[model samples]
Target chain A: MSMTHWQAAFAARIARDEPQWLAPMRAAAMTSFNALGFPTTALEDWNYTSLSSIAEVPFTVGASASSTTVADLTPYMINAEWPTIVLLNGSYSPSLSSLDSIPAGMLVMDLAQATREQPALMQQHFGTVATSEHAMTSMNTGLMQDGVFVHVPKHVESETPIHILHVSDAAAAMSAKFPRTLIVAEAFAKATVLESFVGMADVAYFTNHVAEVVVGEHATITHTKIQRESDLATHVSTTEVHQARNSHYVNFSMAMGSKLSRTNVYTVLDGDGGGVTLNGLYLGKGTQHTDHQTRIEHAQPNCFSRELYKGVLDDASHAVFNGKVYVHPIAQKTDGKQSNHTLLLSPDARIDTKPQLEIFADDVRCTHGATVGRMDEAGLFYMKSRGVPAETARRLLTYAFAADVLETIENETVKQALEQLTLERYAGSGNNTAHAAREH
Target chain B: MLEISNLTATAGEKDILKGINLTVNAGEVHAIMGPNGSGKSTLAQVLAGHPSYEVTGGTVHFEGEDLLELEPEERAHKGVFLAFQYPIEIPGVSNAYFLRSAYNAMRVARGGEEVDPMEFLDVMEEKLKIVEMDDAMLARSVNMGFSGGEKKRNEILQMAVLEPKLAILDETDSGLDIDALRVVAEGVNKLRRPDNAAIVVTHYQRLLNYIIPDFVHVLAGGRIIRSGGKELALELEEKGYDWLLQEALA
Candidate 1:
């Protein structure tokens, strides 16, 4: 069984002399993961995605790396603007990382170091934000190896973004990485964290990552995740967030690579006058399958939430988006809006979208919808009739579709990089790009 | 020069245009006035190579080459333009960008150099003034959130940029007020030259008053039943289309 394979593998790792406070938590997570097992289509949340393919592949935790150099990773770096923390095959790579001028009262180190140095702080916030309800989150909790932990003290806004790069070093054998991240922002603090995943193409690997974020009162946080794993890899990521009073939180998850990927994000506005925005962009091509599931919970009054997820699907690819906005009965004057838009570029592409809104408060306002539309034929013809070629017209419309979501990004450095990546995706897709218009 | 002989086209198993014959020389404007369902717009779209219409029997020779054999953009590159009856709204693409791309494409299609955005802005500013449009309009998405008058004016702006040899204005006066109609018509008049021609298709003589046509023809039953001088539009304007339809039947 899949449960026995993971349990026996992780038993050896945790058997090492670790912190007593963390040992029981991992054991309980293992128990829950074993009981829940892997989700199937019979379950409502897992209806559109199947794990049979991932279940068949043999996955090992924290496998050793295979000669990955810094030069090989330069293509994935964000270039001089920010400090980077590098992880190679789920292990901290200090030789590849560059961290300078770290602020006081802030911690930017591996989870192992935090467990040893700041055990009390780790005990207070590590497992508090994440729950082991989902099987995959439980799996990450039980077997997660070395990952980064970031903590910002009150009113110490980060001047630049902090980059976290996760690189998979797999050769021949199917390696697995259970990366765990815990971030905490004190009251009135502001920070932006960029999590980027990069790996080799056609390498069979598994990356199950879980990130837990907590924002104190009046704090603001911008958490961005860029998942560019190998096309032959299986990526399942879950992010859980909780915000305090008068806080603001934003989650931007862009998935452009992987054979099968699923991103599950859950946010709760626990404090009055708090706001949250959940934004995502997915580009699915070939036989890739991408799924996004988001849930926003407004538990307090006068809170606001906006969620927008857009997907572009081509070839025989499939995309699924399920967004839910829930307002509690006592949460009066709450405002929430959710929208999902998908553009189908080929006849074989398929999309399934569902926007669910549950509002129990009579004074609250909530609206949600989903749209699956093809490229505008009349618009394309109009552009073509103006002398723009049909092929360039198609690319223009597709680029416009992606830019709609990218333009809303708040960070300039990240936004420009995303725009460049989107253009590269388009140029790479048109195998006959020799005919593409390069006249300026 | 443009010439069409016995052109017949169908839209989804029904003939929208049947046996349409017309010709326009350089520096000439031929106005085709027809009643509703008389296939006026179909003729315009067919000439511009719209794929929705199937040309079953037709031979359109634009400057002595078969125009129907080319794609829509190819036809546009060959100096065939259609000012749409309803300009489509394309969100997320600015008006100036769309215009520059179209203009550069037309240039490159005929073996000319493509202009950069900064270089094309000079040309665009001149044309925008003709349509009395603001620079803000050029920055917004094409036709998105634009009023009817603004959309019509944008069509003229594109025309002034491309400077097509054979321009087909399809019902350009449908949704415009008088002031906007004046702006659009004046822009067309300014773009007219000795080497280019235009076909003004409308249902009323009001537009004809601004842009005087050299030849006015009445279309009925999918054919040009009557062809006369510009005075024909004034006569039809005063009497409506009933007498013309009855005369065609007789």
Candidate 2:
């Protein structure tokens, strides 16, 4: 479909129900989306990823929330008691959400309802950080109807994490869903936000998600996203963050499923003494293509940033990782480190990794490295010499290749769950496997 | 218990072992001492299947089974072990996990039930004592960040657990101090049985003072040039390999 077709379809189908305050922003977003169009290989930022497959499909927009019971969500829930927000097909489902236990000062509700109740908050942050400068994010901003809106008040220190579960149960093929999420943590507050994008059925669809995070001064926040979409789906998500002074933010992204998936995370340390860590692990098999593009901007002095992204590719799958760390001229005393490592399991698997560092500061410590290689043969032989079968040895090493990233997760329950998922994905099935042999 | 007939192997285009012949019987410790470039480590690695060396011509029989026809792990299951000179470091896999996996694999190969962590821990505790190592080593990644002595001791600990019938020690004493060498030698000694044999390949005879070998052979230019009893090692230690090389040429 062409850009005009998308704009015309959006106006005909979605313009009737929006409030008057959002109409101008939506129109401006539509104009931006039209100007940017869909990113192609011509763009440097998207050199390795192609959107032809997605652009060829005439995906119908405005898919309604699918009807699902609490039982359907059993397999995806990390914890049963944590406050949950469910977004089915692009729209929020109140019946499936359980926010009754949320703290008194915390606000967790659907984005559309939050827009009505907290219009000032929505207008202030909705499209501010994740502006309409990019194509997919711009399109999402133009068409987004419902998503998640979370606000943790000053000094709230929410112990229980908020889970945003995005489920795509498309009634028909070629369905498209646009879900947005806005998280705001006030000063001295602490919170963890987990977003899971899961496709219930094996059907062709498209999911364009946009999330914006605001970490106040002296606050700490952890944001994790686990994407397990359908093998036939196309998933593109962008997360933009702004950090205040002395704030700490950690973002963990794991991409396990989808035919074509592109994940972009852009974080700017806008205040002095702030720190940020972006860690990601992507597993690809079959003909899947997983791409991760991250950019961290040190806009202030004395900021610290660390990033480690690793990919495990098997079969004929392909993975791409491009990490860029920019230190502005005024951002002196910056300490930044970035690394991208890939492990190719099969001979046919391929990975393209690049670590781009741009430092304009005269006094700064910055380092970046990228490595693309196969499993260690010497290590394999050592294991085999100890009586481990070749197949089992390979699995163990592959699992170990991805285990270090899981070690950086602070949430114990989520870390264990993600570890188990990683082990199962790479280790396959066997008696006395790594999962069974785990110590504590 | 083990026999090698006319064994010839090459690493890449360079021949490392040429027309070597040896036999090891049960209850015997044979020491193959040689100078540098004498294929001592190559011979040991070939016996345990290092995969880097290509055996062009050889017939190795371990207890009447074709040892060369099996994979490394199969050879391991058939009671063959190689204590590496430079043990490879495997990160992210705990030492206890690797030990239990190897132990269970050997057990299952022998048609025995696998042991649980509790039972495995008990067995590990005993083996750690054999090597004079503490239990702290078991929680670390396999051989990762271990000192030289710690790595060698970990190898000996594995030897104690696997209990292979034919253990090949490839320069196992090269990087050990006096205390570590004695502990390693004692570990090997305690694991010895009348039904098992060992091939200790070394350049120096310092290690033979602790673990005495029944037979000592001098390997030069990929061939065993001389053979004698335990006293031959002491003579080589005193006289060096030059006199033996001249005698072999004459």
Output the number of the DockQ-best candidate: 2
Writing each residue's lDDT as its tens digit, candidate 1 over A276-394 gives 99999999999999989998889999999988888899999998898988889988999888888999999999998988888999998888888889998898999999999998898
TM of each candidate vs. truth: 0.95, 0.97
The weakest ten consecutive residues by lDDT in model 2 chain A span: A431-440
The most accurate candidate by lDDT is 2
lDDT of 1 by residue, B54-107 (tens): 999978999999999999999999999999999999876778778888998998
Model 1 chain A lowest lDDT segment of ten:
A431-440
lDDT of 2 at B67: 94
* Candidate 1 Cα misplacement greater than 4 A, ranges: A101-106, A171-173, A427-440
DockQ metric, candidate 1: 0.51
lDDT by residue (tens digit), candidate 2, B26-74: 9999999999999999999999899999999979999999999999999
True contacts kept of each: 0.60, 0.58
Displacement of the residue A91 alpha carbon in candidate 1, Å: 1.5
